[model samples]
Target: MIKTIAAWIGSYADHPDPRSALAGKIALVVASNQPFYPLYLHWIVGTAAWPAWLSLLSTPFFLAVPALARRHSFAGRALLPLAGVGNTVFCVKLFGAASGVELFLLPCALLGTVLFRPDERLKSAIVAALPFIAYLFVDAHLGEPVMMTSDYARLVALNGMSVAALIALIGLLCSTQLATREVEIVTTEIPGARQHVDISD
Candidate 1:
């Protein structure tokens, strides 16, 4: 069953409608951002209903730890629900009106990369591309009506960039692992006679 799923994901490289794979990622980012925007608005306008301390402590642990653990399956699969719980706590506590959309991208991408086989390059490419697309739309929407302070906006952008970079890095590392695994598999399977194939030939 696992092998079958891996084979299907691997087949994505040959699929025609490449964009469909990225659709879910794009939707998640856009939808999450909508609610997050209003929260930022409240924070900027000084009408933020929630206290800063309530968010400051919990949000980081909830978002960061799972994100870190998500690079490996054993811990990551177990911790994802915990991460979701943290996200829920944050959403309820910080309830003003901002899209916490940015928060989910890294986690989703990390989860996709870790849970799926590394040979599914198409899926990995889609996962990597979605965050970049989401950022462009989010950046464009961050003007005028949703008036955030320049410093705050910069901070948010920087954080998003950092998370995106981290996701890409994780993807690259996973790809390397997959390549190494493939090479090991091939080397081990090579017949003794064929193994003597010379480079000069």
Candidate 2:
């Protein structure tokens, strides 16, 4: 069932018609234009919360994963600084504060790299899950009695939707890469009759 779902998603991504792209673009625009844009408006605009800062810091890394996978090395490199700034801001926000929240970007960044690199199936699976792990941690922190509220619920929903979109995008990219690799493999194979030098001896 999982395989079927993955294949169906891959098919949609691999052969995305104009309509699909348009719909995707439209959705993104709407999501971005909402009264509380998930990343910036809700998390950064009015909040002095440390967790919000941490969330902002992590955003660039998540955003850049797709471009990195597509071999956009320069852009990927550029995102590192933004990610760093986010980390710094988070650190400042959390200074002299309780350390109950497990915070580490290294594993996540490594997983992202592994996922983006070609021919690393196990690593890709691990990397694909990194975001969810981070999400769980964030959810735990945000769902604490002190942090939970009706407004926070909306923020959680927005964050969840953003994460879902990121995951879908990554899956689409990996599928496209796999399809391209398969096409190349098939194209390069020589038929029995087309072999120029056949040595059975």
lDDT of 1 by residue, 5-45 (tens): 65653443221222222222222333334345446545554
**What's each prediction's TM-score?**
0.38, 0.38
Candidate 2 ranges beyond 4 A from true positions? 1-150, 191-201
lDDT score for residue 200 of model 2: 33
lDDT of 1: 0.42
Worst 10 residues of 2 by lDDT: 95-104
Supply the TM-score for candidate 2.
0.38
Any idea what lDDT model 2 has? 0.39
| Span of ten consecutive residues with least summed lDDT in model 1 | 13-22
Per-residue lDDT of candidate 2, residues 1-201 (tens digit): 999975654443221232223223322332233333323433532453434433443543534433442354333432433343344234323421132222233333432453333554453454445445554554344332322223544444444565455446545654665676675565569565224333432
The Cα local distance difference test for each model comes to 0.42, 0.39
